[model samples]
Target: MKKRTDQFYLVREDMLSEAMLKTIKAKMLLENGKFNKINEVVKEVDLSRSAFYKYKDGIFPFHTMVKEKIITLSIHLEDRSGALSKLLSLIAQTGANVLTINQTIPLQGRATITLSIETAAMTADVTVLLGKIEELDAVVKVELIGSGA
Candidate 1:
């Protein structure tokens, strides 16, 4: 048997229980400054305090999950002149701050590059950025390797 400690899922809003949905609304109210206290938010959202507390730290909007975090990407590129420079320039255009970059020595005209970037200031969605990267002529593949604070 396997133990599940850290698992994530993407569920439709309609599939959630009323309490869970209310908890989400309550949290949003607090975050948006509409309510100063948890009590106020719970009241506005019609959720019980205990139920709000139960799901507060467990659920988050999708954008909230990825915003203001660092993401690592693994990219396969053709070892051609200026390919790396163009790639970095494209990433810069998205307003993402590059934290670190690692590249393997070119082997058989191909190289793998790993990049860690801060997404807090990004102007584009991560998915959009990945799509743009994939369309680049010299890029063979791009994979979201990991993300963290």
Candidate 2:
């Protein structure tokens, strides 16, 4: 007998096949009330019903995974003046409420910050926010440590 276990990956959109991408589009059309029927959604996105069904249960947009949930992030940052303030400001711009924040004392010009945030009111996808954070000059690294209710 063989056992099967589910696995997941965070793949970039461009890496997905055309059919998989179209499947995502079809699913979105149905979700946003733009189309009620799967047939309509498949036609709108130029994907066949079979292809849509094949990938529908497998592919999902990144935002859907974190919506209405609380997530924890571990950030490594340079100990530059106002770096922490700037980071918090960026997070606020995304509409994610900061539930709690803990910071380690700067050692050798670097610090670690752990943040718990509520994503229910976020204005954009969590991945977008993380990308923006990664672009910051003072940020060393950002990791999604955990997520839950």
Candidate 3:
């Protein structure tokens, strides 16, 4: 038998089944207080109560996955204009939200940058994102500083 692991797989919205999507919508309605009862939520979302119950504890909205995850990265960058801008733009394109940024003065044509990102809405996993970041011409190195659950 294959070993079992405790991990959640992140899937694109388009890949979700219609019933699963409805369950998410119903849960959202209830969580946001738009509906006071499960029946009302199910009716509005076009989901059956049985289906909602089945998926309610198994699935979560995208933001819920990263609500407590914060990844810090230490990057060495070349000292030049548009370097940081390009980096930030790439990150944005990947759907990661930048939580904080710290930079030290450049010396020897290299600068150190530390950035914390919330990966809840990120399009890719940390490893993949870091690889993409390191591919930038301005980036000398990218290291994962830390991650918190």
Residue lDDT tens for model 1, 32-118: 899999988898888899999999888887667666579999999999999999999999999988899999999999999999999
Reference-based lDDT, residue 17, model 3: 92
* Location of the lowest summed lDDT over 10 successive residues in candidate 2: 1-10
Model 2 pairs whose backbones collide? none
Q: Rank the candidates by TM-score, best first.
A: 2, 1, 3
Off by over 4 Å in 1: 1-6, 9-64
lDDT of 1: 0.90
What TM-score, to 2 decimals, does candidate 3 have?
A: 0.56
- TM-score between candidate 1 and the true structure: 0.62
- Estimated TM-score for each candidate: 0.62, 0.91, 0.56
Best by TM-score: 2
**Residues 19-117, model 2: lDDT tens digits:** 999998888888889999998888888889999888888789987876647999999999999999999999999998899999999999999999999
Could you give the C-alpha RMSD of every candidate to the true structure, in order shown?
4.8, 1.8, 7.3
